[model samples]
Target: MKNQTTTTSVTTGQMFRFVFGQVLNRRWLLGLNVLALTVISLLEFVIPQYEQYIIDHVIPRRDLGLLTEVVLGLLGTAIALGVLNYLSTYYMGIMSQGAITNLRTELYQYTLRLDTHFFESSKTGDLMVRLTSDISNLQSLISANMLSMIGSIVTFIFVWIYIFIINWQMAVAVTLTFPLMFLIYRVFRTRIHNAFRAARASQAQMSNQMQNTLTQIDLIKSYTNEDLEENRFGAYAQTNKQDMINATQNQAIFSPLIDFVNYLGVAIILALGAYFVIRRQLTVGQLVAYLSYVAMLQGPIRAFTQILNQLQQSLVSYGRVMDILALKPAITNAPNPVNFPAIKQGVTLDHVSFTYPDSDVSENGPVLPAVTDITFTIPFGKTTALVGHSGSGKTTLTRLIDRLYDIDSGTIGFDSVPIKDIRLSSLRKNIAIVSQDVYIIDGSIQDNILYGRENATDDEVWQVAQMADIADFIHSLPDGLATQVGERGVKLSGGQKQRLSIARALLKNAQIVILDEATASLDNESEKAIQHALENLMKARTSLVIAHRLSTIHSADQIIVMDDGHLVEQGTHESLLKANGAYAKLYNAQFS
Candidate 1:
């Protein structure tokens, strides 16, 4: 995982660089955007010249011939400006959409590769907002915001220079008002930035609440808590609405104030230019050109204000995204990882100890001492069952063996090489787990079995299905292997779902198998069938079985009993029953 730093304030040059980096691969779009913007600016610059020509030449002469020519010129300029403006906006739309796709793909890929710890701390909805809204805002900055900023600055400079050339006295008079406008804008900019930031935060908080409500809709219904959930959602929505109203109010007030100042500047220019004309210091045509320049300049200044607000919002969104990108995966493979081919020996836990990252020892806290300094070994070609009461760390220990988490204080090795050093792909490839809770996809039985390994032959699918005793059940269905499982396998009974999960694990043909209470939720018939399948699957593979019912583990080569986080006993069923330890006590209580 790559850790990203918070982008509190990005420089204009840096933002340009980032936008360019995102678009570098899309050269066609880049060329189109540049070409369009240039043509549009060129058309706009020609406007003042056209106005001057019409005012001085055609009007003074009262010549219809020259008037017709001036009208044609103005019409041509309007048509060209409209065409160029359309092209610029059209190309920007295409680029913004493409850039959004690229950014979204990268963000999703990076998020998936992040370590489990990051997920433990972040909410799904918050991460989702970062993916969708934040990235979209960035695209907005690249497309509309950048273009507006560029166009405004270009127009402001070009128009000012033309005004100076036409009449310096009027240009200077209009220029004098800019310092005050800049000061006023700086204050407005600060308020808008803060307001937009608050709006984004409020929106993210509301999204989080909505997601929570939807995910737990069933729970709320069962508990008859609709009114309570509605109140909670209402509170969140209200907060978001308030923030948006504040932001909109600030923008409304800011724009009108800027417009008022601009009008005042135009009035000043008119007064001064008329004086120059009356005194014969400047021509009427020159005054008309100066006023035209002032009108053009106002468009860019207002545009600048809008772009500044957008830039601030983008910065805030970018900072949120960077917060997630900065998190490094706590569990990852070594740089030069080695492969463990066959698990020739066995899996070993040498004084392994682990504690959850955000847990403490308490009833309400996370399970205490998830795993203590426990040492164990299971030889190849045997079944070793892990039996314990609930919350006795059975599942946690299994997770450690699979390297879902690293033990804090000991070594977990596969064939004697530290598990962390072994290539993660190789380690997981050789192990298969059928957890107590089965998950079925919304697809055919064939699809589910083949999910264990893509490109699996149909023959291989039937073989595992038969081995797990699910082939007969599928054959009885109307669609057989092609039958849909429906949402989360809701169409199948708990026992059927368990059998399918078992079939999935068997299809993997891994050397090390883990059955975490695999048959705990099944009926007697399904349990017997699944247990028989387990026996066949365990023939040559080293197996770790967690069974809630004693009947499921009677044939184990060794049964390890755990209490809280410590191992209390390990022996064959008969031997442990005679030893009268934790395992024996459990067996007698449950099966005697």
Candidate 2:
């Protein structure tokens, strides 16, 4: 959905703000976590000071009482540190999980509101990766890396100030490595981010490939293309492997280089502190305490390098997640939208034209519109038939009336009010479509039927099923309405699925019904029964029927013939035959 070419670069501060905004919602839990971390940091600083007391004061005075007191102080600090650490870790887990849960729910709900065009153009696998794996990356940062980074920062500041107070000269010499380490991070930051981005892309590709291959396993086996698909999958796996290795390669080189710098600082401080002790300018205890402080400082520096690696990876995931959230649906409700009024004058399209956004250019030249300058009406309480070949835009016309897409030109009206002015929910609730391609969820027969009207009574569901002539087949099954239809209704026959779809529409009891080749999959006997049921369903309501079998719509009150996105003819079936125009030719061709 995102147009990468138009996307601007986001700074680190912006990314943090966006991510932390979601995380900081649980203020009480975060407050407790901060309190624990602060206390833990202060306790860490106190422990080394106790070590200095024993060496410089207690041991030198040979005072057993003071030694025991110092030991008891050390024990108390360690216990307090342990308890605070537990509380901090526990509280952070709750905070991070809560934040991620809310974020995921919001992302999914927003994604559902996006236009149909977005789904048509995007791969399911890639979207799944964004929703699941990408979000998990952010969770990992919050739960583990982010909290640790905060602690490291606190420790670094406390130890740095303490070391400087004890001996500024040694502290100054030790900190020379800081600038070099920072320079190394700056140099590798972009390189590491790019590598991780490549890895995430490759991971998405692999997920998409797996989803495609697995869902179409039937096609693969029928054509005996298993080996072909295997090889293809293997290629994606290999690419992902190479990408991960490349990402890790950047990290592996960067991490140890940071460690080398850190220890080098420690080495320099060790030598300098020993020199100060021999000069009598520093006590042995002070030198030991200073070395401990330097080690404490190195912990944060080393942690910072690891945190840098995670920060880069988390940014990549965050960017991917944000890209989806940034997209605004092309089709949205108008401001102050009113509910669609009850139909009286029927539906009208005046010089309507539309071209799909994802339409591709052909060898001839630019892409052509799917429909053009079409003006027609479906009279209220009458059956109107649309007769056309494939890609003649009959389906597109139905989609437009339902407001699944907006027309590029002209106006579509319902009872003299513009379709766009009506509330989308109210408009769609009045229309029911039973398309040729029926999609049944992995649910029970009752569940699928109930999808049409969520609050419909069980008796009402059965009545519609009986009217659609699917009751007989349903009765034959052991579980009847309770029978499970496997994924996409793979367990059902073609005609059965179509009938189930009709049963769904019948239960909807909408004011306007569009049957696009609804009976195309049915046998002659089933088609006749469905036609009779549809006649009853269409009475006192507007109906638009599309079928290639011209005989199917011969009894319609009005017929419209379309060719290559243009309306070519309109008349009753017998009248069209008398004129011997486009409608007549299509009808004759089928019978002859």
Q: Point to the candidate with the largest lDDT.
A: 2
Per-model TM-score versus the true fold: 0.90, 0.96
Best by TM-score: 2
lDDT of 1 by residue, 163-207 (tens): 888778778887887777787788877787777778787777788
Least lDDT summed over 10 consecutive residues: which range in candidate 1?
1-10
Residues 16-84 of candidate 2: C-alpha lDDT, one tens digit per residue: 787678877877777778777877878888888998888999988999999998999899999998888
The reply for model 1, stretches above 4 Å from the true place, is: 1-16, 360-369, 523-526
Candidate 2 TM-score, C-alpha based: 0.96
Compute the lDDT for candidate 2: 0.85
